[model samples]
Target: MSLSLVLTLLGAIFLLLLFRYILTPLFLSPLAHIPAAHPTSVFTPLWISYHRRGGSQALPAITRAHSLYGPIIRLGPHELSVRSQSAIHKVYIEKGGFAKPKFWADEFMSYGVRNMVSMQGGIGSKEHAGRKRDLGNVYAKSVLLGSGVLSDVAARVLRGMDEVLERIVGEEDNADAEKTGSGVMEVYNFNGAVNADIASSYIYGTDGRTNFVGDVAKRNEYFEHHGTWLKGKHGHAESQKWLEEFGVQLCGPGVSALRDEEKGGADAVVYKQLHARGLRGNDMASETLDHFIAGAEAPRTTLTYLQWELSRNPTRQARLRTELRTLPLDPTTDIPNLKALDALPFLDAVLMETLRLYTPTPGPQHRITPPEGTTIHGIFIPGSTRISASLAILHHNAEVFPEPGVWRPERWGGGDKERESLEEMRKWFWVFSKGSRGCIGKDFTVIVMKLIVAKMYSKYETEVMEDGNMEQEDKFLAGPVGERLVLRFRAVK
Candidate 1:
């Protein structure tokens, strides 16, 4: 009961607490055996979170960690990043045990409603599967390539191309020569406009679609507002409300047109599918709004990068145009056959290479471990551990992709000798991710990108006008940091 006796007991308890909380996790835990991205990573997530805050710092730092430590590295006390083919199969492919973290829900929820992207575990998983099933058919590769879907998509894309051409080459007689004639066009803005126009056509039907592609003033307004809202220039609450109202406005016409007894247009593909499965009101609107959002962003990033890359390399552009010339043209529309376009070897090579280098969703596709736990690269990860694999890292594996930073499409053009290397590269390609929960809109995005690229290159030769600050932004769906890609177009003649 003396004061000295009390002090000795207090020191004993403090040492026990330190050993249990800090020392054990730092040295004795199974996760400690894995390579740490930073000295504090074994006990705290602060290091990783600090780097990942904003701007494009996390990617380079993580890439360096993988280089120093091999395939799997501990990003935090409970977070692991693996960049191996085996990890991809086990985490994303082998069944669906690794569920998405709430990050998707927090970032992707539309109209304050959960769609597939925002759905987590529990009944949410089942609901997501049902929603995917309802809308699967329209986005299927076969359906997208079919005459019916292709014709509708082609009409929309080509109409957008007309606006682009008019903007670039100008009309013969116009009061405003500046708006009409050959000059620098912002590829990023035009890319979003066309993608939005095409995606909405399929979502709501052609009759209810936005004419952003055809109407230059309207497209400028939409993109400008989006930029301002994203920067939080106006208050967050006000910006979010404006976004919600925009979603409603975007969806209203399609919903009304679909209900019409004498609706005479291409099928409201997504709406019909969802209605058939019994979703109505905000439920239907959330799913459609998410689709419109998806349609607008990632594809636009891909197209922008594709144009930027091709514009910088004239020989590649010449080669691509030569390949495009071989496509069989449709007698009626003058557009090439969609199937033939997909088959062009050089065109496919160009696209595959662009996706490899500038993956839009280059950030980690995060997944949490099962309750049972699992081993990755010989290191045992505990249950409910946070795990992820970044396309930015995997796609840059120098072994799979020699000179990983270089933009070389010929790497994808595997002849007899490079077949083995080509197969290895494909195994590491996670641009869309893989498995049951992979991107449902892959086919739609791919076909649309091909249509736009093929049509643009065939008619005009592009040269870079301004490409400063072209480093891609560091976010889930990343674009250029400056969000600008200006290019000058000259008619092929």
Candidate 2:
């Protein structure tokens, strides 16, 4: 063939390849029928990335799209956002045909390591199930009843609070005494200290032999360093690529320290015991540690919000304190029984309400359709299409949670119809998520939250400091907006 003819043939092949790989997927894919959140949604990742970086705006934007485009809205060339409760259940619980999408893997990629939370591909589900099974008993409500782990952690938390309270009170008292001859003094880090100690104990174990609560400097260092790693622009992507290139076992120093502690060091002691007690196949130790690390910031955030809310509404705070006092406190001992604390109705109501209003880490749970395909909201979704449901949007849905922003625990504690409505709301409460992929450390979280709130309210009166910012920061996880929460606390007597 002539040179001109050969060039024309090559040009034709290039055009065909471009159309097949790029144009068709962007403009003619199965997702084309759905509404796009941005003008470029059919073509690029810019829209999603913009919302991701927008922090608090992320969920609201997705919610708007869902409202406009029905339950399932096209987010990208291959992604769909499923906002309705029925759709969420169908995709996440009943179908079980969708796998966690790559975004999570991208977002949480560590130093050449992929923990159960961020692992990708086919192996993740089996591995996660195995790991979850291994430590199930360790986190069971029944196990916590007799577990020394609970009491030991509670003691450590009380000790930490004492120190924190003493320091704050001393400062306040000194300032007050200088200004006035005689005055009452108070302070509150009640939530922060308690959450820190509880998280530390759960991760490091209760024996006092291997306690992260004791290693304050190290814990601070780890969180600070890991926080940097978590936020670096390319950290997650680079880390994931490194893991794929090198073996996951060969994680870097930061991740290695975390994993080693969970797998074999003193931190792993509690988990090892659970494993020995017939909790087979699961890696509860590592999973628990991961859960603690991933979750530590949240309870502190919740506590800060609770304190702020209570401070603003002294009557509510007083009522809660009365409720706490009415419960029998140990006459001679400092700690209350786990069952009694757990069963405190008012405390439970307050926490449930707090969780409802200020959901920690209220992000979307994303999944992709299986090879066999599936249908959502009566629309057929092809295999490999991305699907997600946002807990923030669902929790704040006006239909389910009237006056959703209001903090009213009483709404959850009324007559049959009211209680039934609250229960229905709880069924869709995605705070810890649901189904097989639900939070593994939920039991531990509840226990610690109850014990901390119970212990604090039992002994001290709390108020939000005047200068503190009570709003929550909506990051990868919702944390205290200001990064620090200072409160005023006084001895109950």
Candidate 3:
């Protein structure tokens, strides 16, 4: 009506908006009691979002926040970063209490489709469980040891390693007299290739999968796409399409029919299983790509670091070699008995120690607070808000893991003398995470790592030549910063 009346109404609305969006969240909301990582975090996510984009600095900053302000701190108007054991347990293992955050989809999708990592809510839960169930029997320790499928997979991987060893000796013999390993094998890419081949073979079949170990440049190219995808670098979407097509080709017509593939021959092992469980064509391919992407990074990272640690100590390497030598069969055999191979005390400790200190995926797993709203370190967090716990905080807890950053294989002991400390260490070990939604690939990865490590140490001795940027990248699925781990492997006399 009149200008004065309109102006008065507009002023009232402005004040109301201010109170609801800013003042209330800053000083009057339920989260008001929690300390803010940045003053502006009380009103907006910009403060934390900026830090997140800061790359490797984000986790350290959050760790400082947790150190300064107790276990729970507000990172944004709708987000919280939690660090206490109680909070992490309640959030992750309280019967699937929290839904995964939205960023999973932003970063982890394959050809614009939901994989197990990107899916959320009830549908996500059902799909994930179905997939896990389909592979559970296959991944079981007993099955992996005795089953023909894994035996064949193991046979192929060992054959590849035999080739790698031959090349290592050949390179040294052919090199200049002074250059024993001037051209380091740069086995990180080869390790990635072998693991990718094994994962794909298991998902598809030896016939259907990649022979990247036989083609280092092609394998490295596949990993080049991985770098672009993980960094969200330019052309990630385009690269994702290429990855999806690669996965589709790996799971073509008769892959599932192979006796060594998915136990039931469902969609064609992994692809067929997902398809049968309702992941349409490309989505099935997408999920398969998710597995390959996962198989490519974390396992390779573990193998890389394990080698790095071993290379630093010749005494430890010899001890490990002796332990590996105790195996009933040598590296060149059809395949070592999984049961006997896994029992090597020194080998297991070395792997466990590396997993503890050098976890590849040592990043925050974002989970939304559930409807019921939970308390973390006695601070109540509201429902439907983004909340997370980083593996770094838990794994590096000095109280739980003394000298946490140092790599000491002896710390993971099997004897009566160290059993007590080992128990405490297990509680803090979140490498594979823990929860109803925890990684189903834990056993598979562990077995693969053990197999690779056992085989490598048994045949050759590695020394790190140039591991530029050994620091783990600060991403959800991180590897080394430079993406190159150069090492010289010499055939054992």
Clashes of each: 0, 6, 4
Candidate 3 RMSD computed on C-alpha atoms after optimal superposition onto the true structure: 3.4
Q: Rate the local accuracy (lDDT) of all candidates.
A: 0.78, 0.61, 0.75
lDDT of 3 by residue, 1-493 (tens): 9999999999999999999988899878889998998888899888787877834437877888888887888998988888787888888887764777776545677667777777774223776676666544655667666655665676777688776677566764421112535435666677888788877777666667788887766787788887776777788787767777777787674343545444654223455455445655776676677777777678888888888889999999999888887777634555678888777777888888888888877877788876778777766777888888888788888887887788888888733255337777888899888886677677777887788888778888878887888888877667777777777777786
RMSD of each: 2.8, 6.4, 3.4
Q: After superposition, how far is residue 354 of candidate 1 from its true place, in Å?
A: 0.5
Pull out the clashing pairs in model 2: 131-283, 186-489, 187-488, 187-489, 188-488, 188-489
For candidate 2, write residues 1-493 as lDDT tens digits. Answer: 9999999999999999778767876667766667787767777767887887844437767877777767677777777787777887877777332577776665654443445677553323676566555555767778876776567666666666565455445555432122322222222233443565566455444432223233544445444544444444346455334323322221122233345655654433334544454532223333344555554656766766766677678777788788777677555446677787777776777888788788886767777787777776666778878788877777877787888888877767722244437667887678887776666667777778777776766676766545345565555676555555445666677
lDDT, residue 29, model 3: 84
Model 3 pairs in collision: 256-268, 267-272, 267-273, 268-272
Clashing pairs in 1: none
Task: Choose the strongest candidate by lDDT.
Answer: 1
Which segments of model 3 are wrong by more than 4 Å? 1-14, 54-57, 122-124, 172-183, 253-280, 330-333, 414-420
Worst 10 residues of 1 by lDDT: 172-181
Give the per-residue Cα lDDT of candidate 1 at 326.
78
List model 1 lDDT by residue over 1-493, tens digit each: 9999999999989999888779988888889899898888888899998997743337777888889998899999889888888887888888654787876455667667888777765223676677778786888888888757556666656765765576556644332123424655677878888888888878877766777776778777677666555444455556557666777776677667667626554556887678778887777888887788788888888899999999989998998998888787777766777778788877888888899999988878888888778888777888888888888899898888989998888888712244337777888888988886788888888888888888788988988878878898776667888898878778886
